[model samples]
Target: MLFRNVISILLIFGTPSLVLGCGFPPDLWCSSPEISEKCGVEKQCSLWHSKQALTDVPLVRYELYYESLCPGCKQLILTQLYPAWLKVQSIVNVTLVPYGNAQENKYGGKWNFTCQHGPAECVGNLVETCILSILPFDKAFPFIHCLETYNPSTDGKYCASLYNLLSYWPSIEECSTGPNGNSLEHDMAVKTNALNPPHQYVPWVVLNGVHNEEIQSQAESDSLALICNAYQGVKPAGCTKTGFIRSPVKKIL
Candidate 1:
């Protein structure tokens, strides 16, 4: 299955609403206070995005569901996702869901998970997800890519101090190591299981809630081309220069 990093927002009178878009759901998302706190900032977040981020504006909601230590996942994220983000960050909202295709298991009062790369990958998954929960996308992403670039061969807390993410360790350490961490990962598993047409592997890619098939093969090579073609507004000079045909994405009815 494919995991989605969906967030929820709390209402004025305490009613809750499901929120799915880029950025932390909303401040004070009461459904899960501790989890929500990790995604919150000192200032309250607005349910409404800035004018540039409104629906009318052409936007590509890039959804990447991948394991933290998978080779293909790492390649696409560092080469495809990050670079494409730099080019079109003004017009896109990239959401990363690090759970990928793994399932969680429980036994003997302990929670466990398996990753394509082995036990170490599972540990890396928790660390990455924990980072995202606290840091904004821009900060969290660079840390992820940097660690991958510096030591793709090894994955885990080794680079936490290297990136100074350890400064936020107090905030995330609880979320990544205990039952709290288990619950957070559980949320990801739930979202992954809910994909309308479940995915077949890691690094599943989607744009505007639809699957992008061409990405499986060309992500590292031509992701910007895909996003540029899919964009539905005043074409940036970059997009026009390519004159690329719109690549259709598979929409779920």
Candidate 2:
């Protein structure tokens, strides 16, 4: 009986089913990167290279905390922010921190808070960091898109997809199963639970390893343009201050 109980517990907690199958169409996977040479042309491909350059550099570094099963995280990446970054070819290295199952406790209890809807934002960070370490952004982008499509309501499906996507090539399954996997999630859970209390939220983006006034103020659109211009060495001309407000967390930092 004890052995059976242990097995049940392991099955319950060892792996959470957050990832489903790939959300993006198959054609996206086959598209060639060569097609997108310049910014504003085939923006997604350009951004992939830009992100690659940023991550490839030794000095520049940034961390993005996300929950793997969070829908808001998906909207933030696919609908709002990443597209812009792709257009500019922004060379910013990002770290992904996964906070699993933001909506419920390990015992399967629900907690109410600001962004507790899903785990996509926090987990997205983990996937990003894992991809950065192993595969280039070009190959990593599709894998990330696949992971983001996961629906937490289903359980483990998203995680399974993530496992499959990285199993080939550089193989990120090791990282997913390593200390960083749980560590990042634990850190994010502690921080978010403290901030909102009784509820867990994800997609906490920290720039330059500090979530201070400088990064927070600069994140604002009117303000972000200035920061972007300074960092990218370009004027903020024609850069509209719209669509950066997907999450209230971005406003904080």
lDDT of each: 0.62, 0.44
lDDT of 2 at 30: 15
- Looking at candidate 2, the ten consecutive residues that score lowest on lDDT are 15-24
Using TM-score, give the best candidate's number.
Answer: 1
**Model 1 residue 125 lDDT score:** 76
The TM-score of predicted model 2 comes to 0.42
Question: What does candidate 1 score on TM?
Answer: 0.65
In candidate 1, position 104 carries an lDDT of: 79
User: Taking the tens digit of each residue's C-alpha lDDT, what string does model 1 give over 1-253?
Assistant: 0011122222332333323332443433323545444544212223322222344675777777777667677777766677777767767788877777676788877667876667766767777777787789887887778766665325435566767666776666677777776767777777777775687777788777887566544444567777776777655555544322233322211
RMSD of 1: 16.0
lDDT of 2 by residue, 12-104 (tens): 544222212333332342145432221112444444445444554543244445555555556555644455455433444544444534532
> For candidate 1, which ten residues in a row score worst on lDDT?
1-10
